[model samples]
Target: MTGNHWGYGKDDGPTIWHKNFPVAEGTRQSPIDIDPHQASHDPNLGPIVLNYDHCTSINISNNGHSVVVEFDDSDDRSVIQGGPLDNPYRLKQFHFHWGGKGCHGSEHTVEGQSYASELHLVHWNAVKYKSFGEAASSPDGLAVLGIFLDTGDDHRWLHMITDALYMVKFKSSVTDFKRFNPKCLLPSSLHYWTYPGSLTTPPLHESVTWIVLKEPITVSEKQLGKFRMLLFTGEEEDQRMRMENNFRPPQPLKGRKVRSSN
Candidate 1:
């Protein structure tokens, strides 16, 4: 089904996703609650290596669901390796999911506690797969780095994004956003939880090897408020629905093991 057909509404929410994408009912579904005490500590799991020093960040856009910042992945200039991956995965794009003010908007939870929002840095296994679309459906195709966002003082560089929200208030709107390396957005620590999970959005492909960070980044409440200003509908559409609470609730663990890095 098309993205427009599925949304965070009463009639089109996660509860009914199984009807459209059968994989929604899969055993390895994503956004699962992370219980730190239950997770196994693997000494073999090395620290994840991110080589984004010279990464080429392109433009940012609003895709009706969330605001996405695209990157140029033509070469191996921007790639992630080590940890749970056998080969380096090329960085594709990054996006955020959030809720209305004063509510949790994160897709995944820690000990059943949800953060204000979540950040997903999507990458594809360019070595094993030729294209991102091809990799997105395979078992070992993608790696998503999830970072939690909490309400606090304004982030130092987040204004570079929130300031540009006015340009892409409507769906499918995009603008130039050059040289913005996402490495600046990462938390101080790279210690994370790793697992095999599906895409939080539809098709709900079980192709992602999730690496969720333990620490959360702080962003002011005013910055998050800017996200709510985006409209889910096009400018021509008569109905205006503000975009908020765009995250999917955590799914069942289904006996999948969560590995932690040292």
Candidate 2:
């Protein structure tokens, strides 16, 4: 979870992922260009929680375009207890979104505006886990927690894993990370915008209850620069072939209503 060894470097890079995973056909992805004028009403949302706490198996990887700190060190899954998810779910993965500079990478638009990056805390309802592969094909199988990011502080929260950057890369590895509580990164206020949507990645399975936190967290420009130093592996050849932009575009609010727990 902490070491920053993973990324699109020279060796284990995106080109291979493209070959193996190629974008799933008809998958709803992220990073779409939105026009602010398209803002819509946010309805009333249900409950949410962060379940299965105590321990986690963390992973740091270069997901093509940006570096992500994925939660769940192993099969031991941690808990996040509640928000707008309606039911209890298991914390699975946490990843991030970034841009060449600032001004992009978030899935939802704010009154039509986008931000530099976004962090997603992905979760899955335990009831559906016995067969998540199958359940994921539907709308209620997954739950994703979103947090917006902007420029400012150095984001000491990231220090939670910053020192680990020296560990795994090109050849992804896992480690025993300490008390890195995801909740610590959350703003004191829990105000959020909720909606029914699909995973913002391939397989774009429409199995999600998305909770977008209202307050955005800040990370310094220097901290962000560290991401660029990541290498899928070693060398220019491998670096040129890393995974980037694994995000799915937003689906039509398709007459679908968005609920908020403000």
Candidate 3:
């Protein structure tokens, strides 16, 4: 994490990430376009299970990349299992990638069609590794559940998050946010496409096992506008750059099998 300052700008964008983190060019890169018809349905893959009833949500912050809501992963109170996972992955945090007014911003797409935004619920293999940092570099270390967000009617619970956006409108800003359950963000269906992939961000470790939902949630344009109000630069910086289009484009599938659980 030293000597590497990567951002979604012209000078420090994705194309040159490999200069700092060689793994950015790894074979299992993520944010790939999923073709439902091409994905192989796996009867062996059971329904994914999520037990987040008593999840301990910590605080929310703007980390220059996206607005992140971190959770307490000291225990397995919030965990996702089944599907392609042999063991449960402990929920750590959730973040969003979005675009500026009326632009597509989702990291992953389907049939080459992009969405307005994308949400990534990141988790780590706590059972196998002692800590998230240790697991983050391993091949089977992380599991990120990605959900798409489209512009439409205002989402029921999304306002709960958007309303808090002002508290962290600048990079490195944080505020207390507790007792929030992410289950409210999920779509009705649990069907997903699972594959081996890497983190979309730098130190682009090829350690993530991605599970992308087939269905997308709806949010209003006004609601998404709140996110754009935030800035990539800190409050002290002279220039204020609007935070949008913070998503990496689709990478090469590289012969990876995308297994669908339907």
Candidate 4:
């Protein structure tokens, strides 16, 4: 379960993750199915605000699990506040979880319905926590904005990321991806469903305050196909595994009330 041994394969997938990361079965685990009807509407919940105009995107890389775009979080240049957050959380990185050809792969679902993919923009509590690693372990230390991706017409700004996917196709590969602001990837509406949940991947720490957008961004099948081309294995590895279906299924809600922004 250590050092890239865990994967989407039958033997090493989410079903077996609990053997290593015991918290995988924790009460507040994430990627839960969001039942809109059951979610309580909070009248006092303010609209979530994102200030990413000055975000310094550093690089894009393949980390054997998913493709991640890392940002320079040394300062509070870019952060997310309002909504359920008490303070502005510093933006750390963004990544995607997707399925194979012609399959739905989103982590969190709406009323049991699945989307083609999910995008996670991760942030940390810089005011209270000294480092991202420290923030990731404490409850209420992280905030992750989840956006669903539906297949249809092409997404105008998504091409900026997809165009560079070829450069980091293999695991551990990284390339310079500067000056690319993720604000362009957002939908017009900021309406979201908020909850207290954990990370969807390994070390599934229950620290994140999840804000999942109600609106889904559209991208063409051709664009999604580009992500499928990425390999989970490194270039030197003889057995090349296609990086697809890289999503953990929805976890139990555990009686936690999901709140919706008005």
lDDT of each: 0.93, 0.57, 0.92, 0.94
For residues 8-71, write the lDDT of model 4, one tens digit per residue.
8899999999998899999999899999999999999999999999959999999999999999
lDDT per residue (tens digit) for residues 25-104 in model 1: 89999999999999999999999999999959999999888999999988899999999999999999999999986888
User: In model 1, how many backbone clashes occur?
Assistant: 0
Which regions of candidate 4 are displaced past 4 Å?
1-4, 236-240
Per candidate, the number of residue pairs that clash is: 0, 50, 0, 0
Cand. 1 TM to true fold: 0.97
* Poorest 10 consecutive residues by lDDT, candidate 3: 233-242
TM-score of 2: 0.73
Tens digits of per-residue lDDT for model 2 on 1-262?
2122323334423333334334422343332333324434444343455544564645565544445565652343575445555556677667776554444656666766766667888776666555455556666777778888777888878766556655544434454555567876776666776666666654445577777777888877676555544554444446444333333334345455455563
lDDT score, candidate 1: 0.93
Compute the lDDT of residue 107 as modeled in candidate 4.
96
Give one digit per residue, the lDDT tens place, for model 3 in 1-262: 3457999989899888888888788899988999999899999999899989995999999998999999999999999999999899999999999988899899999999999999999999999999999999999999999999999999999999999999998888999999899999999999999999999998888999999998899999999999998899886534348899899999999999999997
Model 2 alpha-carbon miss at residue 46, Å: 5.0
TM-scores for all predictions: 0.97, 0.73, 0.97, 0.97
* Worst window of 10 by summed lDDT in candidate 2: 1-10
Clashing pairs in 4: none
